[model samples]
Target chain A: MTGVAGVVLQVLLVAVGSPLLVGVMRQVRARLEGRAGAGLWQPWRDLRKLMRKQAITPAGTGWVFRAAPMVLAGTALVVAAVVPLVTTESPLDGVADLFAVTALLALGSVALALAGLDTGTAFGGMGASREVTVLALVEPTILVSVFALSIPAGSTNLGELVAAAEANWLSLLSPVTLLAAVALAIVSIAESGRIPVDNPATHLELTMIHEAMILEYAGPDLALIEWASAMRLTLLLGLLAGLFAPWGIATAGAGALGLLVAAIVVVVKVTVLGVALAAGEVFMAKLRLFRIPELLAGSFLMALLAVAASYFLV
Target chain B: MPDLTYTELLYLACGAFLLTGVMVLWRRDLRAVIRLFALQGLALAAVIGVLAAHQGDLELALVGIGVGALRAGLLPYLMARALAAGGEDRETRPLVNVSASLVVAAALAMLAYAISRPLTELAPSPATRAVPVALTVLLVGFFVLVTRRRALSQVVGFLLMDNAITATAFLTTSGVPLVVELGVSLDVLLAILVLYVLTNRIRASFGGTDLDELRELHD
Candidate 1:
């Protein structure tokens, strides 16, 4: 019963709260840049406005374009339900394997990229290609770094990994943990279309990787993509916090009160991470497209080192 | 602040040391390279300090402080001074590009782990376990020396190798004698002073400190 409630709570929290996470990040960046920005509810307001408008499909586009947003949002929702965000007793624990979660995320990305290519616009195809390039480099780092983390826990199941971390907090200070944290942090930045990888705020034709793909998206479709993206950012940040700092997360035997407290704690953790990421973005410029591969490679190296350290240093 | 054991803390320091070494290869700016070298030095000192605390050896603690001061403080300051005088702040083009250098660094790290297995097997303790990281730093430093074109970068590479040697000595044997460690630090200081002068001379003669320009004198 608690497992069921945890999934529903996680899904609701991610669905309702991720937009505010995006809003908080924007506000933080705005304040840092000395702009009196929109309030924390702006993303929610934008979503509301986007939903009321008529959805548009471009001429000659097929089901891929029509279906991509739903696919993206659906995958994110499933990930939210399964990722052990508020509690380790996720009902979908069997599907919460690290590889399964990563592939689920990748499936969303591939859906969007195909949609981008289906649009047949030059920018759409270009953005699709670029996104795939980044995804290719990022997936390995994510897998390997988490693989390093899993070495200590002896399980690839997300729930078990967090449970192990909660049991032995000392492992968080190990070199392998630290290295994987740094590597995963870098890849998360890249995977989420953040600055120094892809500039989320930019819509300039040449510099945009993510924005170009969504250029043809409008109305409800655009809102789904935006909401899904915010959810993904929240999910990744929440997962990092859960994996590295599992404090306040509920264990298997927890009751209803424990689940509620865990939900609040996860919101706090993800919010803090989001704000920090936003503040960090204020100081960084987007890397050149060619240079981004180098950054990703550097992260991959760290992930590789993390795995090596986990084995040899054990 | 966490209740980390001595071995875990040492591993963290060694990881920081190895990371800084690889970052030196990734960064193009000479100043950033020097900063990373200083960070590596600090990490090396940390490795010593952890060992000192683990063993409760006052002498090792003192050596750690001296190493931190000399390597992290004075050496980087001197290198930065040379950098300001030389005016070429970037390694515009190395023999290898940044991505390739990073991949090579990963390969070297793997190689270090493979080769250090026998050492670790000979005596399976935490300290011996971390030897491969120091060895990785050593190989990466040598790779930097061989591949980088700028004389200042080469100096950073040499210091990286020196730092790795110091780290290995401390990790494998707890530490060397205080007097020998001090003498080694002084020798490094002297070497830096000589290199400092030589770098300035190269800048004066060639209007830049790029070593490739010196090939004209080979004839």
Candidate 2:
């Protein structure tokens, strides 16, 4: 796998595998609750049906409302490109730094929030407000978490950071990594609008946070938004896997056998993570919207500890 | 390998100790404060034990054992008993809000680094690099004392302040002299005894143990 080919494969992996991961999680969640859930191909089927249908735009919404889902999906695709999935050397390696990645995610969130406000509904307004607040709080955690790795990596670039971790795999065993991983995991769940922050399977108007913004979208637009969010989840989990234990991510110029092994390793890691996350979600209830900040604060504290440990210890 | 790793562990434990002091400033629950205080003490003892091991000093290892037993264990146990008997399980108000105190703690940490830079340069040891964390803990401990309302929490803050000093002395030089360690640990036990007695008196006199109630005595 050359650099360009590896980057293309990584992008395709996220775009194609994103829906399946969502489906697997749903099935796992359903099984944990003692029922046969939708099959693993359900998200693809949902996307197909959605694409065939006509998208309806609301009467009183502007271009931002119409454009939000595209921007959201587009930003997610860019992030997928930048994040190393099954390769150590990305062509976009320079731009795939931590701060750049976070800023892109923030851009998507802001676009969605603006769209939420543009809809002129109380639910959209409230959800947008909540999303921005949560986003601001979680940003520091992500920064500190990433900074903890950067301390040893000597650079914030995701590629170099992964390389640094891979070079000294023992650092991954440090208490700093433990704290950062926990912080990053919690931040990932909240950022992706997963369980405990906002339930993906839910659309109860009163309890929904992410869905409130998408309430006005009808057919294809809704499909795009759904796919985009799922892709973001896939990319984040992939990033986490790459950072913590990227033992098998194919490097540039690796043989086909290496790429095959990388693919299998990535699938196993992501599947295990998806199932673990779904299983964990089954036991925990969605926290109150107010309480979510407290959780994020705790995550920030953990990340702060990681940063402090790296500073003083390492 | 063990010496280098243990020295690093000592530095990380110093961070934990500082974090616990900041936590006492952040949390309002009395039990949470006591738990964090105990964690700080544990971290303190771990730092001592790790450094003692790295240096291979038997006397310092003995002091580490004593610190773990008294500072981390016996003292917090006694404090928990006092808390239960006093029945003031929450610190309802503070002189400053949590967010403000967090900012102050950060600023004080910066100040600690600035003030300790000369000392750190003088020693030029890996352990001396953590002098600021020890100083930050000392400052934040007093911040906790000033902000928190509960007498038991204030006592924990006082203990935290003392622990930070111990950490500073240990990190900057060899572990504090053995006889001094014994004397200070005893001083802590006696201080806790007096604070416990005073807390009970505050509770019995004013029907609560909040330090704000003590202000009523000035009138």
Best by DockQ: 1
Off by over 4 Å in 2: A33-36, A173-179, A201-204, A283-288, A301-314, B1-3, B86-88, B93-104
DockQ for each of the predicted structures, in order? 0.74, 0.24
Residues A1-314, model 2: lDDT tens digits: 37777777778888999999999999998898999998999999999999999989877999999899999999999988888777777778889989999888888888989998998999999889988888987888899899987987788988888877877887776657877898899999999998899987785887888888778887999899889989989988988899998788876678767766887798889989989999999999998786687677767766776776566555
Tell me the whole-model lDDT of each prediction, alpha carbons only: 0.92, 0.83
- Ten-residue segment with the worst summed lDDT in candidate 2 chain A? A305-314
Model 2, span B158-204: residue lDDT tens: 98889999998898886667688678878878888998888888788
Tell me, by TM-score, which candidate is best.
1
Query: What are the TM values for chain B, all candidates?
Result: 0.95, 0.94
Candidate 2 matches the true fold with a TM-score of: 0.90
Report the error of model 1 at residue B102, Å.
1.6
Task: Judge candidate 1 against the unseen true structure and give its global Cα lDDT, from 0 to 1.
Answer: 0.92
List the candidate 1 regions with Cα displacement exceeding 4 Å.
B1-4, B176-186, B217-219
Scored against the true structure, residue A241 in model 2 reaches a CA lDDT of: 92
